[model samples]
Target chain A: MSTNNEIEKLRESEERYRTMIEMACDAIFVVDAESGSVCEVNQSGLIMTGLAIEEIVGRPVWELFPEDERDRGRELFDTAVREERGRRTSMHFVRPDGGRVTLDVTTALMRLSGRKIVVQVCRDATERDEFERQQARLSQYYERLLDSLPVGLGIRAAINATPKIEFENQTLKRMFDTAACKGSGITWDACRADMDEQPRIAITDDGSYAEERRLANGQTFLYTISYVRDLLDQWCEVTIVQDFTRRRQLEDDLEQVNRTLEARVQERTRELEEKQTQLAQAEKMASLGSLVAGVAHEINTPLGALTSNNDLFIRAIVRLKKLLDTSEVTSDAAMKERFDRILDSIDEVTSVNKTAGERIKNIVNSLRSFARLDRSEKDRVDIRDGLESTLTLVSHELKNRVEVVRRYGDIPPINCFPNQINQVFMNLLVNASHAIKDKGVITIRTALEGGWVVVEISDTGSGIPKDVLPKIFDPGFTTKGSGVGTGLGLSIVHQIIQDHGGKILVTSKPGEGTTFRIELPAR
Target chain B: MTASSNTDAGRSGTIVIVDDEEMVLTSLRSFLTLETDYEVQSFLSAKEALQYIGANDIDVVMSDYLMPEMDGISFLAEVKKIRPEVPRIILTGYADKENAIKAINDVGLFQYIEKPWDNDDLLIILRNGMEKQRLMKKLQQKIEEINRAYGELEGLHKEIVKTFV
Candidate 1:
């Protein structure tokens, strides 16, 4: 009964081995080691070779290999049989129909029916090798693309209070070459400190952002940072840095140019306004000149007739008297009385006419000289003459209100436009006259001081106030009643003096007097 | 020249006046006739005055400036051409002073009197011009008489010399 049990056990073990060989996923086959022939093959082995069982059972294993691989295949089988060892190799096969197969093969020596045989196991490896090669190529391409980027790129992580620089591209490596910390192994804390502001990068947000920072070396950087989840699902910040100093400097220069251009435009506008004012003043003076010429021409004719008529009346009366003296008209007491009455009446008329004619003549002469109607050209002008003419023109206004004193010194004539200079004198003299209340003294003094002819007009009257004196020559500045002054008189005087390369100075004590001194170039 | 005598003082030489204004002409003629002892002739136009001067013996020619047909300066210049020895006077307005000065320098003007002139001054100036003109004519007559007498004496001397030789 024990012998029977042993036989059954051995039989059961052999059946289990057969079943295991048949069901193995790998192709298992038995080959004759000495002849390199296939002795038996499993169902999987037949399917792997694409062959029938009769064609594979006794076929030489070398026939299954390609021509070039048959020699190595035979040698591996022989080595496994003679050395009683197991061997493994990758074998290339050519099927009967010229199709190629690549297999991972293992040959082991086995005793079958008391003869040494080789058991071969093969697994198809073409798909796995192809997959592995594709993975290697993809990784190489990705590395090359990362190194060629323009902006410096870095991956950073700060976890559990330990900051790490996980990956830095080739651009980052080159950038760090010139940085304070000259390596790619940089911490998040170090990078944050290098930035101009705090909170260098945020990984909580999933979108991209940009920021600008200046370094200690005066270099400006614009960094664009984006959040990325790595393969381990750990969040990190990706930073892209660009130098933007040159662009910022260009913008600043453009702004400065705009400011300068605006200032120049304002200056040009002011200059044009000043020129326009000068043109208006010149036009006014020219019209005044023509008007004066017309008045002078009109008045002189009538004045001549009136003056001559007075002379004629006086001569006629005298002639009649001479006749009476010669006793040619038969004189008597009554006739003599009548002749005396007529002579006295004629004398009275002649005196009145003479006074009236002289006054008219003086007025006409003043108007003509004050206008300087025919003196447009710059010539040698006597400053004293200008002052005298201005005084004469305003004599009516100053007749009883002011006493005039003339203290004139010998001075050379100035080279100037007489008309404009006379206008200045007229403005000052009239202003002096108007300043007096009831009765005051006006002193006009002239002198030669260094290369200049100086005429000083001083008035003992209500003087200009200290607060008002400085603004006297500004356009539209006036202290007089609105209709009493156009306010352009002193400003024009000042402008005319400046145009002649001259100066006017005023000194005043309120309630005491005011003095205007004009200096003109003598040459 | 006729000296100023008591009897002929009111009836002396003739004075001609040319003026555009009738009032001025009448006044001037009346004044000259009454005050001075000169005969006066008046004309409204310078052309008429020229024609009258051409027909008559005139001692002085007075003309007003700014006339219609011809101004005083031009009229005086024309009168000087007609009678070189006659004195010319201009009655100018004050505005015509520049033209009057030019006339005096260019036309040998004896004098220029502004309008509404003094009667005494006009009479005196006219009397002087008339006296000067009369003296010049008399001097010419005397010179002619002397030349004629000398010619006669030369003819007698020549006859005597010829007979002696």
Candidate 2:
């Protein structure tokens, strides 16, 4: 019926079909359309159907099916032949090893030489279904996780311009007084009053949990807010609120305590300043009283001399008058000699009077200066007056023992407390005069440098001992022999100068002369 | 020239002592009148002394450094302008080094003396004050004499020119 070339073509096509069926991973079974016999079968199909090709060959593919299901398998195969297409269906097959394999069977019809063949592609779908069931269990587990989480979490549906509450976790329901504040979509405005003001969270597309929040129980919290945008870009705000209310309260209390402490410290400082001012005033008054006493002692000496000289002059004049009254033209040598002696005595009295009177006037001027201070308390005082006054006060000490040389310079009036400055100079001068037992020169000089007035007092005297030098400015410390000086002299001097913001430096050697350098700010 | 109309050195000049304290003024006046040849007056205030100075012939003016109304420095400076030849001196109690320097530099202070002063030292200062006063007067006389000679020479030259013409 067929030539060799045509037979060869048919055989070749059949061989290609056989190769495709045998090598397939899926279960492939070919059924004869007209005879309903099993024409071809793959290894998986034979293993899956619990029947070998020898038993199934030239027999209907429905033969291996159980008697009840043989009709169903035959109907499905007949439909594929009629439709010439395949569609998926779930089915159970008895395997060669006596196990059952659930499969998704797809039957396709192929036509060749007026005969229709059914090619069934069966897929082993049991493992895939089992995986799907496991995934469903995992989804239930996640739902349980979201329910039991300790932190207060919430989801809001922002379908409209104003977001509405869609879901609230258990923790959130507990934090707020759920009976009142929960259901009607509570927002920041509803809770941000004295009743409850909690920290608000931010909404962002990218998730970052903020460790800050506010609870509805009138307590602030620390937590984060995340904005979950949907496919429509409408943001659903998911906030994770945490409680840090106690920490905030602690910080507030600490700030309040710090402020109170600062206020107390400032008050104590003010009190200390006031005490310093009062102490300075008291020291000044004490020095003034001592100065008055010194001046009083000085005035008495000259007054005594003047009184004696006056008595001498009056007596001499009376004696000369008496002698003249007695002698009228007599050549009395004794009377003339007496008159000459009386005249000489009167001259001596006149000279002494002049001397003592000037001395008294000097002492008086010094007292006047020492007592007077500018009523304004501080003023531009002629610094020379202060120095001259100090010189006048201490001149007696220097009279014969020390030769005081004034190497004075021009200096303008400087703003200061004049009397206090004078007292400091008086102490230094007196000490210098005291340092010398015999004759030595005390040189006082002054200059202006760097907008400041400098005064230097140099003395040729037995200097302070090196061992006692550092103690010179200490209160109640003295280098002079006891009874000769008050140890407070240098201390008082040092304090007064320091109070006025002046500098005093003393340079000395045991046997060499001493020099005191003083610098005062100029007005 | 403060010489009495008859140019003589024997005429004693008046000396005024100005102090802020009443005790010092009274006591110093009494001592000076009783002991010295000069007519001495004491003023308790620099203002009063200034007022007295306008009409009086004062050769020497002594003032205190510190005072209530005005300090001795200002008063002495004012006195120097009014009567330039009168010698002025400042006496004070404190031996303030800077004040002494300012006093000497600002006002040519005749001398600076301290309290409890030596009697001989005071005498020497007073003598020096009187000597300065005398010297200033003599200088003024010499300056007047030189002026008079200069005027005479000018007159003689004019006369000689007229004769030559």
Candidate 3:
């Protein structure tokens, strides 16, 4: 009764094993050890080979492999029986329709019904192998794309605890000395140590780090380091390097060009200002020339009448003297009295004419010295001469309205163009006189400083405003009303003084007064 | 002085002077009258001087170059028309010397004198001008007398020819 129960239990166990094998996702094969023939196969194995169970049951297992892989399949089957276990390997199986499929196979030694056999299990690996090959191709494409770029690119991957150089593009290798970089592996610490002398590392707002390095070869490079997740979600360090030498050279050249252009613009502006000043001076000279002609006519008219009167006096005196010397006229008291009355009248007339002649002479002399038309060359002249003549010329403008006070100093003569210097004095004196509205005083002071002759002209009249003071020496800057001033006086004065290697300065108060100070070289 | 004395002894005529300025006329008249025996007539207006010249005999006419009514050139030109034998002189200022000189030939002027002339030079010019006028008058009188004498001689020849026939 116990033996019958044991047989029934064994049959049930066999059926359970068969059901488990048929339900498995992988294909299962049972091979005879001695004959290397297929003894059993699962439904998955039959479906994988596209063969009937009858055709595969007694056939050699190596026959199911492709013709080229049959030998390796047979050796693996024999090794499984001899070694009792076999490693997993990939093998190609041929279907009866001549199609092929890749499979991952594992074998083990087994004993069934007192016979030694091999049990092999294989899984369809076609899709998995194709996916892995695609992954490899994509990785190689990415590396080639990085190597084609001008900018150097590299990657360091952390494995376990140490960072290892996982990838480096061709550009990154060419940018640095490969032999030196190999000796000291590329790491953040190693790079920092390399730039110890001039360490420049900047952390950006985005948490990326950037560094600039100048090598011993005078090559400049910029590096940007970033951390990112790679394909397998592992932490990686990415570095990008760029050469900056050409960009720096271009910037320097542009700066040099800009400086030269700025200098040229300033020089051109100065030349244009000089030309404008010369044109104004020529206009002034033309007006003065016409004035000279009018003055000449004025002098001639008075001169003609005075000369005739002088001759008349000479004749009258001689005739009267002759009459007085006559004996007949001396004896007659009546004749003598009449003669004396005529002599008295003649004496009064001569005195009046003498005064008029003196006036004409003085005016002619003043005009001659003021213009200095005869002296075309430079002359050593006292400054007082110019001041006096300028005072004479501007006296008509200042008379009755203004009073002038002169404070002269003892100074050596100066070598200069007397006419231009005289014009400067005239312009300043006239300007001073015009400053007075109803009544004021003009004070002219002169002194001798070291190597310079200083002349100060001050007016006690309406003064220039502080805002208008700085632009007073610029041409066409005028405070006077229209048609009253030409506005070129101060600028002309400045130009003439500068030509003589001298200086002019002015100080003014709004309501108090204004003063013009001039310094001329005493050479 | 010697030239003045010489002119004073021989020169005598009615000298007419015209000027806008009274002082100029007075000065010129005084110098001429005191130094020469010639009779001097002074007028301020050129028109008035022309009237006087037309009525009387004058040896020389002197006029100032600038005047209100007429310039010296035009006034002298009028004088030449009235008395063709009179010598005209222009007195001008230095400023008007150029214009005066240009008008001298146009007006048949004997000379132009700049203002404030020297007394001796004035006397010499007047004496020479008067001599030229005197010679012109003498020449005209001699030509008239020769014509009359020739007419009488021609009448006598006609009468003698009638008696001989």
Name the candidate that leads on lDDT: 3
The reply for model 3, stretches above 4 Å from the true place, is A1-17, A33-35, A78-86, A93-95, A99-101, A109-117, A156-168, A171-226, A232-237, A273-523, B1-165
- Estimate, for each residue in A1-523, the C-alpha lDDT of model 3 and write its tens digit: 7888888899899999999999998999988898988989999988888889999998998888888999999888888988887678999877557778788989889888899989889998888999999989998888889999898887889545667888878887776655655555633225545543484689988888988775443445677889999989998988887765576467667888888888999989877886678676756664564465346445644465575667668666876677676757667888788877888788777877767766665565456567664453588999799889778878899999899998888888999988788889998888888788889999999999998999999999788988899999888888887897778788889998998999999999877889999999986
Question: What's model 2's lDDT at B77?
Answer: 85
DockQ of each: 0.15, 0.02, 0.14
Sort by DockQ, top down from the best:
1, 3, 2
- Candidate 2 residues A89-191, lDDT tens each? 7777666676666777788888867778877777788887788778888866766686688777777777466668867776766756454455544443234
lDDT of 3 at A32: 89
Better of 1 and 2 by TM-score: 1
Please rank every candidate by lDDT, starting with the best.
3, 1, 2
Give the Å error, residue A491, model 3.
8.1
Which sections of candidate 1 miss by over 4 Å? A1-268, A328-338, B1-165
How big is the positional error of residue A360 in model 1, measured in Å on the Cα after superposition? 1.1
